[model samples]
Target: MTETVLAEVLAELAELDDPKARAVNERHGDDHGVNLGKLRAVAKRLKTQQDLAVQLWQTDDTAARLLALLVCRPRAYDRGDLDLMLRQARAPKVHDWLVNYVVKKSPHAEELRRAWFADPDPVVASAGWALTTERVAKKAAGLDLVGLLDVIEAGMATAPDRLQWAMNHCLAQIGIEHPEHRTRAIAIGERLGVLRDYPTQPGCTSPFAPIWITEMVARQGAAVGRANASPGR
Candidate 1:
């Protein structure tokens, strides 16, 4: 039954593949060509199935694994399971979706975060920073926000593209959420000049920390203004 199910799912994924879609994904370092929207739709239809998810993940097909991430019971995997999955998922999209969709919701997130944070591998370390970025925007208690900024300032400019982007995200989140750290965050961004010249589509915000910080803060302030101006009171 498991073999049959896996075969069926793989067939369905193959049916969804598009040459143009693959071209676009290839540019981003993801080899699979299945449209993401269709993949999500399939997952929605299949719903959560831990056994099936594990089988899909074992196949190591990028599209299958992405679907597995969507259908899996996130908290079911133990620490070691997630660790293996992260290491095996080297494709950019696979790596990103695994981290964002599955690992982030797993019970071992904090444990894995600490382990991955200082891993010699920049790709692994980027996952750690991604976890930290979530904390910066959400919980943030017990975090040495200053220390995070210090590390980012020291390394982000020299970090690999993926790791640098993750670090930049954390920096922007800290500036946007914490009033006290805003100045240093902006200053660090300005000094390093990382992502400073990154091209952005018109009407989209640049990922450069200083500009990102300013824009996000302004948006939040504007939100507050509109909320206060509402007639609820």
Candidate 2:
């Protein structure tokens, strides 16, 4: 990939909550790699900010180094290379980006999510969150709701809290996307007892209150009834 523009880099940096880390990534992101160094120079001169660049040059945080790899030119890193980088880096921002960006788009999304589940590191856990949100939402059409529920059920058996958050995010998105699958989701929720732990919200009174699957099931049932009542009767 060609060097990203200073403006684009700045926009992405802004998403980061930490100003210093964002500034460092923006200013020195291009300086480390051979091919990317030229791009960084151009961005540096264009922005006229050398202090942050110099500081980035001196710091030795593995997170910074890992962020530089993704920001400077992600295409250059082989899939296998990310493992080595992850081993050395533990910054939350970098971990979130890897979860949100790299793993979501990689072929190993499932494995990455599983790793995040297995690892105790918050950064990795957050990446697991990202993997579940982005990948599942994007591929909702192709997923088998029954199979997915089974997987999530199995995951919840091993790690309920972590996978529960992930399931909630994914299921909510899926409910929105495939309104027809609400019944199946409600069944899954019942099987997993998601509603038991997180009781339905009181005021909404929607079937899917504490759990969205309830609302989805109600809607789907209505639709199915309508379909059944339609022609031949």
Among these predicted structures, which one has the highest TM-score? 1
User: How well is each residue in 1-233 modelled by candidate 1, as lDDT tens digits?
Assistant: 87898899999999999999999999999989999999999999999989999999988789999999999999999999999888898998889988999889988999999999999999999999999999898999999999999999899999999999999999999999999999999999999999999999999999999999999999989998999999974
Worst 10 residues of 2 by lDDT: 49-58
lDDT, residue 147, model 1: 98
**All models: lDDT?**
0.94, 0.50
State the displacement of the C-alpha of residue 20, model 1, in Å, after optimal TM-score superposition. Answer: 0.6
Worst lDDT 10-window in candidate 1: 224-233
lDDT of 2 by residue, 90-134 (tens): 443444455554555566667766676546754456456556556
